[model samples]
Target: MGPLIWIIDEEWLDYEDEIRVLEQAFPSCAIKKSGYDYRGDLDKFGYLADAIISQIYVKLDAGAISKLEKCKVISVYGGGYDRVDVLSANKRGIAIAFVPGYCTDDIADYVMSCILRANKPIDSYGSALNDRIWGLPAAGKLRHRIQGSRLFIIGLGRIGRTAAAKAKALKMEVSAYDPYVNEEAMDSMGVRKYDSLEEGLGEADYVSVHARLTSETEGMIGIEQLSRMKPDALLINTARGKIVREKDLVEAVTNHIISGAIVDVVAVEPPSFDEPIFHCPGIAVTPHVSYLSVESFKELKTRTAENVVKVLRGEELKDIASV
Candidate 1:
């Protein structure tokens, strides 16, 4: 019998890309698209499958990993594999793979968009005009030019570096706070490095977050950090939501601790209607889609399927999860 491959999520509208790649490599292999409902028995489903493809929605905890008697790999469809329990998978000799660098440009573009919108406020002016309030909206407001503005980045990873480059092109002075990255590296990119987060927050006109969500990073930005930022500064988060405390953010914006915030992610995705972040006038929220683009979407699907094929063929995995 040929190998069995199970796609466990219903995220995509169609499985054409995954199927094309998997079947082209293993013509006789059985490919099952189970979506979120995998019948009633997970153990039986796990026992029959040789490989699995999943998204962030499904939780593959220790108990679930124990059921994958025949599974060789779990290929995650995006950059994050936090949904899968890495320790459990490793103990079972199961490899976890994810796609990275697929959306670096897309995220950088989105961050730049937020920064531009904060400075321009063109949408607000249009809304005011519709209400018969004429004249310039910035008449009494403090507005700074994009050029010569200070931008502080929380993490200097792939997406962070990309955003720094774009900001530099616009003549914005860029600085970053990342212990993992060396001072020489920042200097090479024409960026200043901050040894402490508070120093950067206090000096920046715009603070963009690109840090990963981990035990060390969760709730990293809260009341204290927000308090350090200038009253007219803006906060931008395109990374994981938990990194920034939603309640504290609401408090800061409401109390005028900082000017406002623009976020592509929230602590809880698809948050309830009463999510205070959504109701606050000082905050603008997007549905966590900073990594989406036509090109990036196709690259994500292709690389995800390739990871599963590599594991099944005994080839070294690409973008193997470290934790």
Candidate 2:
């Protein structure tokens, strides 16, 4: 019998790209597709599967991992794999692979867009014009200049570094706070490294978050951190949702603890209609689409399948999880 590959998410519009890649690399492999709310027998599915492709919403916890009999790897569709239990996968000798750098440029561009939107007040002007009101709105008169403004980045990973470069191109003074990244590295990029988060928050005209979601980062930004930022400072988060406490962010923006916030993610995906964050006009929330672009979407799918092939063929995997 051919190897079985299970794709455990109905999120994709179609799986032609993944199917084509797998067929080219492993002709005889069988593939299965399931919805996000898969209620089928996981035990049978896991036992028969040679490889699995999963999205962020599917949780492959320890109990789930124990059901795998022949699974070689779990290929995550995106950069984040927090939903998968890495320790359990490691214990069972199953590799975890994710597609990284597929959306670096896309995410960096989105961050720049948010930063510009916050500082320019162009949208406010357009809204007033749409309302048939001639001349600038009161908000438009308070537009802040982007050039020479201070930008503080929470984490200096791939997306973070790219954002720093783009911000510098706009002549914004960029600084970053990442304990793992050395000052020499930031110095090379002409970005000042901050020893403490509070110090950066207090001085920044804008703060952008690009930190990976980990135990150390969950709920890292709270009221205390928000209060530290300048009253007019803007915060941008295209990273994980839980990294910033949603309740605290709503409070901060509602109370004008900071001028505003631009978030592509929140503590929950598809939050309730009455979610407090939605009620606050100062906070702009996107549907967690910072990593999406026509190019990045195709790359994410193709590379995700390629990672599975690499594992099944005993080849070294790219972007392997560091569990």
Q: Once all C-alphas are superposed, what RMSD does model 1 give against the true structure? A: 1.7
Model 2 scores a TM of 0.95
lDDT tens digits, residues 1-323, model 1?
67899888866888788888999888898987665656454655656788989876677888888888888899998888777899999999899999989999999999899989888866766556666776654344858899999999999999999999999999999999999999999999999999999999999999999998888999999999999999999999998889999899999999999999999988875467578899998899998789999999999998889898999999987589866
User: Where does candidate 2 have its weakest 10-residue lDDT segment?
Assistant: 135-144
Model 1 reaches what TM-score against the true structure?
Answer: 0.95
Model 2, residue 291: C-alpha shift (Å): 1.0
What residue runs in model 1 are displaced by over 4 Å at the alpha carbon?
Answer: 35-41, 137-140
For candidate 1, the lDDT comes to 0.89
Scored by CA lDDT, what does every candidate get?
A: 0.89, 0.89
